[model samples]
Target chain A: MTGKLTVVGLGPGSPQQVTPEALAAVAEATDFFGYGPYVDRLDLRPDQRRHASDNREEMSRAAAALTLAAAGGSVCVVSGGDPGVFAMAAAVCEAIEQGPDAWRGIEFAVVPGVTAMLAVAAKAGAPLGHDFCAISLSDNLKPWSVIETRLIAAAGAGFVMAFYNPVSKARPHQLPKAFEILRAHLPGTVPVIFGRAAGRPDEAIRVVPLSEARADMADMATCIIVGSAETRLIARDGNRPLVYSPRSWDAASAGKR
Target chain B: MTGKLTVVGLGPGSPQQVTPEALAAVAEATDFFGYGPYVDRLDLRPDQRRHASDNREEMSRAAAALTLAAAGGSVCVVSGGDPGVFAMAAAVCEAIEQGPDAWRGIEFAVVPGVTAMLAVAAKAGAPLGHDFCAISLSDNLKPWSVIETRLIAAAGAGFVMAFYNPVSKARPHQLPKAFEILRAHLPGTVPVIFGRAAGRPDEAIRVVPLSEARADMADMATCIIVGSAETRLIARDGNRPLVYSPRSWDAASAGKR
Candidate 1:
């Protein structure tokens, strides 16, 4: 094939945050493929072929993109966040590997984009200042038992957490259950920042005590940030509360300058 | 002051990854300030002023940069990874507040850059496919007790972890000690990927089981990735060892395509 394939990250929410490189990659592609919601973000011309489907069909979608590339069409496989982070980059690579003839001579490139974790962390004022981890509560691929064991281990290890896919339409209670598991080991006063659609229109970011986080407050797109015991919400003048996990502090230290 | 300030992220590693917009911001700046290593990445003209320091002194350096900006110097506060992620962005905002003069009149903007967590995660395949967290291990600002607690929480929560500052010259044993704490709660077979100076010359990325991650294997510049129970290293032909943390999977009965 004379064509190439480029996987582009559309960034966490807005087009403004999309890097110029990602924009160029998409603009240069003759065919664009991605999740349905992600494809909605682009304004395509009449000649460009746009293909999108539910996230569940990522493998097939990726395979289709490669097939198109193999036919000598430059294709862009786009993702909402950085393609490598819980996105379609690997799936595309896997698809390519599974079908030797699909994209035999097609060169592939994975472009990085801003991810939800960083966007939510920024919106929440650095709750990820120290060591933290991200976990998805969705059990579609793995059993809940395995997730529970990992949660217990993470909580005991005292890592801050960014929860992706904490809740979805079918599994509304997953977040509360996850929180209960965490509360069992962490202090009740530990902070939790819930960020919905971070960096997008109607973005909502709130800081609440771990004891106060409710199941109804989140959805598939929400990013839940649960802080360790040392994380604190520092209130600044007339600004959003800044959440930060202290990395270090001298007991004899002076106040903020 | 007639000057402006722009805070930019150089992205994780590699000059090729640096976005053109970020480069433009740097090119236009009369004074460049950032962590010592990041500032060294750019080729500078003789007239360009550079300010560099260790990561711990980010706040101090930011404060100094703000002072310079207030005195009419167009300053570019640069960071290796995205400036907003555990970098100098917050410090710049805080310093602006602490300055003798309000910087509200100064044109200030933050340019997004690639982050180490994303870069390392890409290189290792997809260890962060599910939920993950990024935390710095430097206790220079917080107590080790806090770090220990967060580590436990993250581990207990089943969140993959990207550890920054795994070790340092003065604190060579912290990484191993952290590993011990994690091992106490997690299975010894859990995988840990150590990325040293990722994207830079002499970059090294190694995947080892938790039981084999020794203190001597890491240092301050290393970004350590510890996988959740679901994470596994899959051998791929000619493409290096790939790490995959499956988020969802079809029934084994479906058969691998």
Candidate 2:
């Protein structure tokens, strides 16, 4: 009963972004487990078995996949973005570490996919071109105060930030609070990207200055990009402004060398 | 004579990691421009013109791609990893913003690829499973002091850190300096991964503790992944130990909300 388990990232929302490695894992799998929407993207055949479940069931879902794999069924665990980033990879590892010793026998691997942050960064030009920090604003696993602290630390450290799961029904006010902290530490002209549904057909990217950004602009499907102090918004002719942070950094009067 | 310019990420190394969109862009392009090593990856036909140049000439290479595109040629500007992340996308945008305004008239798009940090994270079993920061240690564009500041801030914030261009012939001591800074704030047992040539035929991944990490362990082709305080190293059966950061953050004692 040595079945293999592979956690795969399905990219953002476009099939065009799916890598051959991830595609191969799905094609070779006997069973699949994922959130309903992401599992639906696989379009499985009648022979392919699937276990569609609710979101935030990461640990349970990983345990289930391991249990299946331990019983001689190859499983493909899927996530919307890169499995390694706020997705199933860590959950599965946690499951394997804390579960019965038999769970360790299952061969496990994670195939990285094109994460939404990268897709969103590309769609909104190169706001993440330089140093950056990625934080998931969903406080389901941690406290809201921790999220606020990270946001402030990231802002004060001058990191262009990519915020995932910025706003959900349960976590509505956190995004605004985050923005307030950013306004205190960052310039008002910093470009803020409300990248909703990136890489999808109906993708919409709204770039606003920090002074004009609002909480209503983001939802669960959005990836909010807050550029660093050095980030620039370059205006183009009859096109949306391009956002980016040049590679260079200015650090003249700093702390001790 | 309108032309289109697309910046494409070639993924880490394997052709299998490339997305269909990036391949489509390459197939449709008449000219390619990139660093010598990355350009060598694109085995194009005689009809496809290539402009391979020395490394660190990102701006010039981007200007060349834009110039070719402005003259009615479809061009694909290639980067080894995701182009928008410390790669050619920002350079191209900078050129468009600073170069002749005519370059902006050309249609521009960025097709994201699997960056090395993600690939490295996958290989290491999701060390970046939680919040993380990516800092490029190359001081060519930024001051060395800024890199030190980022290292300290990332460590203090408990964010797993990914270092790009951590070492080179010219910048030999920065990686060691970085380790010194990280050692001050982090425990000695923290995992450090020297992911050299990820996804390539000669890929080598070394998972060591902060106490054992040395500057010479990394090179230009390496991406250094340093785990956070919460990261764990799980022992495997007849395999290298897996490293991952749990999804949950211990924030019971955070500051005021």
Candidate 3:
């Protein structure tokens, strides 16, 4: 069969952020499957069918996409950022593992896109230029204890961290505990960035010290960046300050020009 | 001043991967600054000027881009992948921190792109569908000791890791040491992926057990992914195997079928 299932990441927000590969996939696919918001973002044509489902139903959505592809249809599974990063790519593979053996014969491909944390890092200076980790703080899939252990290990190891799902109405207290864990291992002077709705028109990026980081500063739309020891702030004469980590770590880096 | 310093990531090696935002920035730029190879990739017009330099001279290249922007020329500093990921965004911000005070007054924005690690992860199924970290193994900027420590910590914390610059001729032994460190914590069966020249025509991806991973498997063009303890492999029916990590975890997840 010529049927195929291609997973595409449309990127965070702006239309300009969508790559030509994603656009081309949308054009070629007979069906698009994804969360409601991402499916709504696709440029739908009369010939294209869309299966927009709730955000939490990733497995079911992936199974449906696979079913269509196995029946000789070109399907595209869309994600907000890159499909591989805590997104539908895993779900699609999981579906293949659990579904009918015939589904495994279908062709599958993943198309990457700009993830939110990188976009947030760009908006706020380059706090992630050094050794870094990305962790989702929500305990929806895993235990909160795992998140805590990862946080302490990440902080103690001096890795800059970009936190996704830092705060949500369902899991509000996790960010505060995370900050406390990091603060215990890191200095209070470490730079922390709260980027809300990055790449969107109302995007707001706030840079603060770890000591000043409050749980209230984050939400589901926010991504937090807690910098390593080398993260620095450049105070401009009459402009907003820029936060960045130098490329090199040496004695010379400690002294400013 | 009409000058603006826009740092854009070219998104690995594919034209289709380049976002419209990066293309727009390049089109509007009067002066393009980057490594010789990346600059050659751009479709430069006669009215536009190009300043390509060696890969190691990031600081000077960034200073030049800022200097041109400060002098009323639209400048674009290019990185092969996402600028925020061990690339020119930090260097451009570093140049601003150390350059003339006038350079600080120039407007600068970082446009994100599809980074190499994400592209690699996409090619190798969804190995990074869980919490992960990215660490650059080149000791050019940071010490090997730092790399060793981070590797141990990341492994102990059970983070799937993407290693960039895993094996350069100058740093041949580092990847082996990294594998040794990870082997102490993870199983020998943990799947490791080496994605060489991802998104390019010469692209190749290799998946092997951690026990079998060799330093020669990687080069400067390779991006490596060392999966967590939970990573899995699915044997295809007369096809290549698929590597992916499931979205679920814990005792409760086992009964989902």
Error in Å for residue A234 of model 3: 1.2
Residue-level lDDT of model 3, residues A90-176, one tens digit each, is: 999989888888888988899999998889899887888888999988789888888888888888677889888788888888899
Q: By lDDT, is 2 or 3 better?
A: 2
Candidate 2 similarity to native, TM-score: 0.97
Which CAPRI category fits model 3? medium
After the best TM-score superposition of candidate 2, give how far the Cα of residue A248 lies from its true spot, in angstroms. 0.7
- Which of 1 and 3 is ahead in DockQ? 3
Top of the candidates by DockQ:
2
DockQ values of all predictions:
0.34, 0.83, 0.80
**Candidate 2 CAPRI category:** high
**Candidate 1's DockQ:** 0.34
> Considering summed lDDT, which 10 consecutive residues are worst modelled in model 3 chain B?
B248-257
Summarize candidate 2's per-residue lDDT along A46-114 as a digit string, tens digits: 889989999978888998999999999889999987999999999999999999888887888899999
TM-score for each candidate, following the candidate numbering: 0.77, 0.97, 0.95
What residue runs in model 2 are displaced by over 4 Å at the alpha carbon? A251-257, B251-257
A55, model 3: CA deviation in Å? Answer: 1.3
TM-score of chain A of 1: 0.91
